[model samples]
Target: MSMGTQGAGAGLTRPAPATRAALLVLLVGAACLLLGPRLPWLVEWPAGWTVPATDWVGAALEWLLGGIKPVARGFSEMLRYPMDWADAALAVTPWPLVIGLVTALGWAIGGAPMAALGAVGLGFVLASGYWVQSMNTLALVAVSVPLALVLGMGIGILANEVPRLRGPVQVLLDVMQTVPTFAYLTPLLLLFGFGPVVGLIASAIYAAPPMARNVLLGLERVDSQIKEAAIMSGGSRLQQLFQVEIPSAGTQIMVGVNQCLMAALSMVIIAAVIGGFDDIGWEVLLTMRKAQFGQSLLAGLVIVAFAVIIDRMSAALASERNRQDQRVTAGLVLLAVAVTALFWRSLPDPAGFTLLAPVAEAVDRGLGAFTAANGATLDAIKNGAMFYGLLPLRIGLDDAVLEFTWGFQWTPAMSLALYALAAAGGLVLAFAGRATAGALLVIAVGILETGVANLAWPFVLTGAAALAWLAQGRKLALIVTLLLLTILLSGLFPRALLSLYLSGAAVFACALFGGAIGLVCAVSPLAWRMMRPICDMLQTIPLFVFLIPVLMFFQIGEFSAFLAICAYAIVPMIRYTRHGLVSTPTEMLEAATASGATAWQTMRDVRAPYAAPTILLGLNQTILYAFAMLVIAALIGTTGLGQSIYLALGQADVGLGISAGAAMAILALIADRLVQGFAEERRRALGL
Candidate 1:
């Protein structure tokens, strides 16, 4: 009579009482999903309700504040006096003074270019009429980033040291990373009363996960042999950590710092919504809300400039540290002092200037002009394109996809068929091995349960394209196929599939383009010299900031989003491809040359194939970068799983958001497994 008995009667025996309890839990969850939303009591709040304890606390705080009112007011006034002086000093400072300071600091740390870049970026922000707001933004970042870094490093170190805690910490970090930023606002608002402090706290929490994960990665990667050697030398724990682990892991930790800074920057705009002080985030948010496109765009640009300059400077410093360049160290110190002086001298007096008013006016005019000139055009284009172009194509493609899925008997039942085939194929390919049967089976059943069999054709086509490109070395065919599939998938399911395709296409295109560019740069000494700074900038620059200028030029759409994706995705491809080409065993290259092979022949037969697996791994990373960009792309009007996830955040639809996020994870997992499998096979073939 029980649920377990009913389940058993249906030939699916519940495992045990504990299992039955879990099943009951699942049933209750389902019931909640079905009924909770429509329940009146769930939606409504009791009227005129006040908690006595909360009132008592408020009264107590008020009474305490009243008693210390004079002291509190005096303290606030005292703080303001110095702030006033600093502001006055900053506002009257000559531009050259600031620039010189920045240049000097840069020269002391890493040298000329980095110092110059920092000075120039900061100057631009100030000159472009954002000095005060910029300072405010900088203040928040200065506070939050360090906190995030310390916490992340501490947690990471703890997790790494204790093996048992690693799994749970990782899981928590994963959930935190995937959870929408908006959800934190509600709880934070309740606790911190919607101020810059709350915003900083939220930003720190959001950013810390990546830093922690990266720290753990770096620590774990430290050579065990080196640690043992340190131990043998009678090194204390602190000594070992500082000398052995920390130094070795410095590069990754710096990378984590880069990630943390970028994440903090992302919160700037959002923080405005929750009473962020200093008007930088506020300006962007207000401009956007007020339809001040140009102003909003400009504010976003300022943020990007800051991000880029800091990125370049930090990267140079980190790299220079690795090389142990005293020049870099001295340059950084000088640069820092210069920056400090500039900031100190250029700080604005809050009392004298009406900063926000000018900003608001400029933004209003810009928005008005933009609306007058391009608003109608954009609307018309969007409407016509949606109706005449996108809608029709989407409809036809959707129909075709549906037909393909339903028409072939093998397709609707493809999950089962694929599993059976993969299992059989694995057995045959491995000489009757079943090493991965369980995994394959679980994947297949999961796909079936999720109803993704409806997308079988495109999936298979993509797989085929990957295989063909890998096996036959048909570059043009591969490119064409990839683009075609991307377009088709984009049309068929624009909401979910388009973003995926765009990401893939962007990665592929950027890889190809970057590879060519890298080769050209590498071939010419002068060009290589010219490109070194650029590459450094690219590596150090935050990925999120890449979206800002892109949005400026292209506006919100697929193009801007794709451009952002390409900018971030191309870096690894360029680096790896160049490394692979340069590192292709010297003996092999010599033998090929000795055998009278042409340069082209040597490259095609020797270098290309030799670098295939490494290049594939780069491609894998590019795909991941692309996928990661999807959520960011939503700011530019992408409607897909990304949009779904975004909406879920806005509405507090955790279940819906998580489910959609799962779909993305599944997509990543499938691509990862397939490419990795192919890579492994190729590596084995090459005896690598």
Candidate 2:
């Protein structure tokens, strides 16, 4: 039987057994939650008498190396030696010759524009006196990215081969990706002892998951016919993977590589806090600490430059790889070897080049003057804004929400009614075709178990009103309704309120801003051109680097925190918007123009409607990004689930953290499901 038939048969046989299993699971979960506090015996803990071998080994190494300082010093020296050589080579080599070589290498691997962009970014770094640090950063990325790619690919292949392992592997990857960067630092520090190695290892771990997931997705998407053909030819698993699967999934795998590279670069900057290395990240940290605003900004620019170069190079490589006929592997190899040889031959002494010091000093002076001039004014503004503006706004909003929910008779009932309405809507939507009875039963159980049945009448009316208003192009009305509903629900249950409002606001704001920027960039060719590199930099530059600057400028508040959230969230919006707009059929555009439609009219009436599904997908991404940033934003201080999660990490409260994280995941799932439903409807309507 066909897979579809098998699936149908399984579905027919599944519901009763699955329902029973689910009930049992819920009972077990309830038991655990209720008795967990009193069941000391159920908790697992390491014996106090037991010694960890890794810790012992680390201690012995620490003793032999005379502690972390000497070990760090030795590692630094080892890495620095090559850097010194590169600096010497840079000094001796004529700028033109080096530029030419870099350009040539780029052209060989990618093309002329990529080579040109690479040269410009490199030259900019050199002139800005950040060449050495940039190179050091590059070296670490160079090592880590490939390692991540290889490891990710291996895992991805295994996941594809072993069908049973897929779900578990995906879950593990999700956890790895979501867990705070700081939480992993302690364990990594214990193992790698704080240096480039630790940073590289951490970056690799952070970067690999997406690649593995993407690779698996790509592999799974390959045509069954192609696989069958390969199998019929008596191809072994390894041979089929190499000859058919990899080749067919080449473009997707390359995309995974690009993601890996971007992820690694981002992590490398964050790793600086754990004493990764004396690269651009270290410089930015140092500059910030010393109140060297100009220096910090300049360091940020250099980092941005490095990010841009790597992003462009990888994108170009991916593109080149996509066009397999144009790729000249032999030529690239020759060019790389020649450049390396020439660079080595023209090496200079370390003492001769004091290029970076002058730049650093100048930055210090400029920053000092700026700070001195604006110190009091800036401080006063910052304090006033935080105290009078933000504090009052947040407090009033929270108070108003609380009062409205508690003081009003109808509001609480309305909120409960909305929940029931949503549940009913979900059941109707999900089961309208064939599984109506099962869906209704599931919804009934969910409502009853959750004690939402009491509020069902109010929730149904309120939710229906809200959703109806939304369907009629009344977004603001919908938003207001949602906010009110959230407030009332939160008042009823503060914990639930915290999770809903904070997560909802973050996602909404992120999608709004990201979508707006993306729309602008997508429409304007010049803006799109300018934004490409900036977007590339944003994508590749470490999240920590972005966080540092925002923290420095705005300090810790909802405003600063939101700004950081928006920065990361905006990427997909721009990317998807641009993609959607560009992918709109040229023939349609011409036809619209021929029909005497203005550009704005064409875009509004044709392009936008056509692109709605893709744009919605971007919004979905924005939600994910916003949710991800919520956890990260805790670093800058905010009291919510994120803060709780961070505190849990600090105290090694894994259970608490996991529970909170699950709550976050549920919020994410709700958004995902809602957006996915909308996207699916749009696609069907559009015949996509």
Candidate 3:
């Protein structure tokens, strides 16, 4: 009893690091945000402050590529074996037989409905006379997916096994995922030049990061008890991983495969743009270029069809209970379908029959009908959007920024002075026993040294501090501060800031609309059931495809690009909002109701707060999707970092592309960090 009391007493006497850190940094951060801008040098990086950082990265990539060329060639040659095999097997096979095989496989995986959908999709492609082109796409996928799976799986395992490397690897993955897919073409073409293999390599690279992330998540999320049990059983390290962790992670890893497949499909068209894949993407491009809107629209649908079938199968493979059953059903269904097809083998030749003519006519007519019916209203909306919405929006944006920062042209001396102020603040905090807070100030100073601090540093610092304070996330505030500061010297800070504000606006707009749908879904079962699939379909459409409908309605401009971003990004907001609200614990709601709360009151007090964290995650996805579409939006001519990438691509300047892409990534990471910080705080409050 005496010792226990002593221990408690000692614990009570110990100082809280977080409290000290928060208080110290808060005072210094505020000073920096307020007075530092007036003293321009105080917030800028030091004179001639080049970091000598990027040279190493370029050298590393060059060295790695040079060193691996022979090995890549040998390994890639081996991978071509599967492509060759699939090619030969399907080469002489009738279109009906191929369609039958895929339909049966889909049925085996997801049952009759999915099978029928697969059959329709495959048959439509054949009937549209695009079977050969799609087959070529498949051959590309067949080779790329396997190679990506192996590399992704291996990298994921390595990340899991080595704790020290995980952060760096994950950072790399995050950057890789955020980089515009078009940007990858720069480095890849420089190495492999223009060939199927180059496209194959690029697609594989794009697909691998998602897979690695999923695998890493799968491994990390495994039950600690299960791992302990494996250890107790005297299993070897390899055996424990293979037998326990890998199996447990199976569902998530397979989900990664599903994502990887979709990413590959998305890239197939884009890859074709870069002279890589010459399949359906090429067909769609050629048609679209020639103003063959009907054929182009049909071709785009063909790509979506392929995506749906592959995604369904991959999802079914990921679910443990259905895996075995699917295989069994697939075999039997395929056999029957093959037999049935043999009876009407003559239908395989599209030259004689016009199976898709009706579909083409319907699409063409439907598009015309929509335009004819709504032309005047659409015109009003378009003009209003162009002049009132877009033009006026940017006009007010720079005005909304702090008056002090607008004409701020900072110098090296001013930047060094800001570091001095920060140092002084840290010293005071440290002397007051707030070492962690002081440490953050020191880190923030380092960020200032990098020279990016001059671009909206006051607003950025204020925003971070406020959010961190709201979340009780002092540590995150420091980390995010350092991250934003590191890019200060890049000359991209203003553009990145512009991109973020645009994304923020789009996300806000999406949340308003998405939240309404989510609220309806929350209250009604039928609405939930109907809206879920619509959201899924919205998400499955590729990045640029979102632009097609937007361009058709609004024409190419800021409004059009913003609309495209919203259309593509809103699905996550809708999905996550619905899920978060619907999945709220029934007991919590009951308790709220019992506390003399009305239905609306209970929802506001209980469900909404609990759901906020999840909705934020959805918002995070929305932001990322917005950025992805934001980059693609450059195709229609818009301003910001994405437009920078567009201009850079035009000059074939790989360095500029990389810099602009990295700046966008930095912007994304900042948003991601803020959301994560708040989510953690929410969970802690709930004690979850």
Candidate 4:
């Protein structure tokens, strides 16, 4: 062929943009690894170039908060009345009456099953002998939830009413979502001093975003025809909004309420770390510190009970199903009153109840015996996971591979061979028409060898740009690069990498394990039936409660933290995976069957690709959940940004707290955008 013909042929064979981006990322990573030893700067940022962003942030916030101290103190005082009222009322209420009231409310909303759940759940809480402590926690929730609801509703309505504010409001909500719950306590801690009011205000602030977001969503989704009808009926703007739009958006608002309740409860428990409350959260912390595992477990269970009851009851409000007879509710309430009157003098203090003490003791004894017998096995499991998985991922194989841990030292020659094999595999894959996959494989190999925390700044930035470009476009790529560069310059990049490593590890495990469980559940109704309630329970339980079981079995370490994160984060993966797989259109299955595809073949070729976007969404949720749990997991022994945030709380260093939180939020926000972009791309590709 002539020279012109050959050039045209080469042009036709050039890779697509995504493929080129992937290859660029791979090359940059490999070059960083090859040059890192000779150019030490490639592997680590210089201290001389670092900005004291933490100190600066602290100084600015201190100035701002100091200015508002008087107003905040007055506000705090005003808020205390409701808090105190709630506490006193709950503290003085008879335990039986509380249970009956909850059961009656449950019956009114959801009928027999909900009523039974409420009764049984409260019964368990009452029997656990933490009634007073539980009530204290509930009081905090009671006061904070109302505050959160009102604040969230106002924000949501304001955003909805003004078109100009919607974007900013959404951005605020998104940022708030990534900020860890504990991070909210630090500045509030300074403002409120050491008291339960800090927890109340912290929780109120932490829980408000969900409500605002949901309310805005609900309002936005209201049928336009309804608004038109209201207008045509000569209703004023406020009348239309209150009487029509808001009422029409009730379901979504109720969803917000449910989420608000959960957030308040979760934050309330976490806020006990500040040592100003005698709530059940405090009880759990106190017992855990004393090594009283049985009592801690009981307290944790009590929290779970409250969570389930609150979650279920609030959730019922959102459903369109017919409610149970109101007379039954009235009867139950009357019965409670009658019983209280009859037994007023003889009733024992709810605090003295210990009906479940023996049960807790048995659990403790059984746990002890099992651990004693399986101590070696448990140690082996933990050691194996650390040596083979986490350690290599943390500090890289070159450093982590040692005679004491991996049984053999990794040598330079072995590294050469590993690179050689990886290059060979990549070449083969490229030749097989999978250039993008091949490039990603090479990049993964480089990361595994170099470790996340040690990655060169240029390489990390390039990789993020490439991924963002592929996921969305130049705009997102620019945004991600800038945000990451800020973290890098701020000197928090190392800790951010550590956070990335742990959350990334947990997400990978969840994607694997939860995906498998989801697949199984998709294939079997019975499996889903069995797993559904467990998933619900896991989701309902507060993030703090997850530490109890893992701490019992594994003790306080990275492993315990890892397990807790996985347990909490895995639910979404499972739920989304099952829903995506099961919700595949019947027509697609029929077509596959007509084409003589086997069940496994249809699943792989038809179902898997169709479910990719949904599965990606699940992965996104899993990532966010893992990051959220990562902060709480710091209480045990996990390191990284989580530890920084927790430490900042202890020292009351608002600067470090806010800066570390911003860094963590940066990572989460980037991950969220990247995953969502990928999911959107998949949806467009599938024409969904």
Q: Compare the candidates by TM-score and give the number of the best one.
A: 4
- Residues 614-633, model 4: lDDT tens digits: 99999999999999999999
Model 4 stretches astray by more than 4 angstroms = 1-11
lDDT, candidates in the order shown: 0.60, 0.63, 0.72, 0.91
Flag the better candidate by lDDT, 3 or 4: 4
Which tens-of-lDDT digit does each residue in 111-199 have in candidate 3?
77778888888877777767777788887888788878988999899999999999999988988887887778766755565566666
Q: Order the candidates by TM-score, highest first — what do you get?
A: 4, 3, 2, 1
The root-mean-square deviation over C-alpha atoms between each candidate and the true structure, in angstroms, is 13.7, 12.0, 8.8, 2.2
Model 3 residue pairs with clashes: 41-414, 41-415, 42-414, 42-418, 44-415, 451-488, 451-489, 452-488, 452-489
lDDT of 2 by residue, 318-374 (tens): 664433323443454456567657776564533345556677687668655765888
The runs of at least 3 residues in candidate 2 whose Cα sits more than 4 Å from the true structure, single-residue gaps closed, are 1-104, 126-136, 186-196, 321-506, 521-533, 548-552, 578-610, 641-670, 685-687
* Worst lDDT 10-window in candidate 1: 41-50
Relative to the true structure, candidate 3 has a C-alpha RMSD (angstroms) of 8.8
Quote the lDDT for 557 in model 3. 75
Candidate 4, residue 65: the lDDT equals 96
Alpha carbon lDDT at 5, candidate 2: 18
Candidate 1 lDDT, 1-688, residue by residue in tens:
1222234555664333323333333333334324545743221222222123323433554455557766645544554444445445654554445556666656565665666676777766765566667766666676678778998998899898899999999867865764445544434444444456666777788889988998999999988998888899998888988788888898888888878887886665566665646657787766655556656666766777877866656656556542345566566556656665767756554333444446657766865677578877766754554443333233322222343333432343654565567456544533333323333343333333323212333333443344434444356335535543442332323344544555656776878887886666545667767876677666555444566555544567766676787887787777666666666898999999999999889888998888778777777767776776776676667766777666655554444444456545545544554466567767888899
